[model samples]
Target: MKFRSLLIVAVALVAWTNVPAKSASGVPTYIASAVTDSARPPDDKAQDAKRKPDEVLAFAGIKPGDKVVDLMPGSGYYSRIFGKIVGTTGTVYALQPTEMDKAAPKGLQSLKTFAGTPAYPNVTVLVQSAAAIAIPEQVDMVWTSQNYHDLHDPFMGSPDMARFNRSIFDALKPGGIFLVLDHAAAEGSGLSRTDDLHRIDPAAVKAEITAAGFEFVGESKVLRNAEDKHSLSIYDPSIKGKTDKFIYKFRKPLS
Candidate 1:
């Protein structure tokens, strides 16, 4: 009897020790134990760029098996990162505006190259008009980086912008997240400087996206810079590649 009791206690202890750690949702955590600590772009060249991959992923709240859409995924920069985070079980859809084929020929070539490579085997590149991107169903997240202001560009126009946001709203599963990051411009300026400065006012972005039926979840200062007066153009030789930026995270209501 004594021996049996000892054996049972040992078994219980072993089982408890082997149990996996779960996240807030009660699902087993899929944290990457080891990630390549490589230097990020924008850092490679002294350009004023967006957030680093790890920082961006954390802010976007990415996880394995989550379906993600990378809007205007130029050169598959963020697409590759999303693919790795989601793992093989997850799907990453890289959306490129058909207009970009003409507007950004270099980016188009890069997309094709990334699609054909095995490194990003799980990414699917979709060349669609910004107005309407045909995705199967609601995704876990829709992410746009440094490109929202482009919606107001004369080439892309208002019609396409409306369609783009509407499509994203429709594509998200209830309770899905929409993450956006762009260079920060002066307050109350709206998107007027987008063409000349390559930046947008944070408030304008919030109003525009929220009007699309998304709830303002939160914002992050991980990429904020106080020294930036938001007066200079993002491409001005002085701050061109290192301008202050804003990060916004929004969520679709669970209706």
Candidate 2:
């Protein structure tokens, strides 16, 4: 009977090994593990309350074994998180725009150096022109957090957004997701504040992306700050990390 019990335990261990990151509800269990991973910097973890990583990941519907492209992965904050969530069998492309790198060379180097370590074995550093963003291959999800507004800036090579969005649409597998999160601006502010205030009108962003043939899937209010009047710079000492924000999810249709 002891051997039989041992055999049963052994069989369970083997089954758990095969499904290393799954929960019974079909949810990818790795997300919770990734949130509390030791590899995450203390600074990144400190922002968890405001950034809401778990809710963000759930809203994006990320799963284990999914390839993800993290656009303008500034400082590799989400890249490391995604690398952990995707697990060993999955891959993450931490895209660093060459223009942004030129603005801060050491930051880029840090991303390269850290991502190269064993801690993030599944991450690949993708360096490319900001105006010509591309993923090496079709991915399950392409996510940009707090940096989509930069696509409108002239310093980032004055990307032709219409063309750029089209390329993003083409970079995903059918039914794949494109997630964007950014600071919120006044409804009619349009592209006016991007260069200075570092905020954007959520409607304009949705219209621009949907025009590229992506279907608007959903949005999240998890990060919205009602106290924000949408008139101040996102960097203002008063708001900075507490600024009102918007999160949107768009999908490439299967048909």
Candidate 3:
């Protein structure tokens, strides 16, 4: 009887010790810190005032020690979050379009300022054409938000679009992820009114990116809205800030 009682106690002790450890492990260690830091608005509030860094980072699947690239990192909105998520061990590359140098007077300077700060010490800002950004090595993840439609816009020219997507493909390591989020348009539309309406057809985006050798992994409807008529321009005053958007996460096939 005593032997059986001792065995029961031993089992209970082991189970008790492991339960808390398992539960603690399930909670992300840096989640609290990341969330707190993200709450603080960036220096350039005009660009990121209305943006949600937490939501975007959650969708991007950012983790500690990840080498991430924030493509078209306008005003370092997402770039700042990525820098914090990746921690000191990981690095973040903030790629700005070469056109910004000509069009945006403070674009390049803003990137430099953010990267130089202690909060974003792990970030590196690169100024190059979206189609042909040069990096020393392939990254674990490449993310572009609200910018994919620019690739198909005629104002950027057809040649630039081809170059941009190809560069995005080359910058990713095999098995790397590419996350894109853009304003949604009606089905069957082929990059229609992308420049004027600030939206793109989901199908057109998938076709173009897939042709560049990325395997379609999956999509999320977290931001989709059935109520959206798909008729009003994304910039229409009514839906300007709250347009339905499509989120896609693609992967480079491991051969």
Top candidate when judged by TM-score against the true structure: 2
**Candidate 3 Cα lDDT to native:** 0.75
Ranking by lDDT: 2, 1, 3
lDDT of 2: 0.88
- What are the per-residue Cα lDDT tens digits for candidate 3 across 78-116? 777778778888999988777645555475676787794
Error of 1 at 117 (Å): 3.2
lDDT of 2 by residue, 1-255 (tens): 999999999999999888746545444577878888998989889999889888788789888899999898888889999999888889999888898888767757767877857999999999999778778889999999998998888778878889999999999999999999999989898998899988889998999999999999989898999999998888789988999989999999999
lDDT of 1 by residue, 16-92 (tens): 98775554534345432112323223432222134444455666688888999988887766776677678878888
Of the candidates numbered 2 and 3, which has the greater lDDT value? 2
RMSD of each: 5.7, 5.8, 5.3
Quantify all predictions' global Cα lDDT against the true fold: 0.76, 0.88, 0.75
Ranking by TM-score: 2, 1, 3
The per-prediction tally of clashing pairs is 3, 0, 2
Best by lDDT: 2
Error of 1 at 123 (Å): 0.3
Check candidate 2 and list the clashing pairs: none
Total backbone clashes of candidate 1, pairs 3 or more residues apart or in separate chains: 3
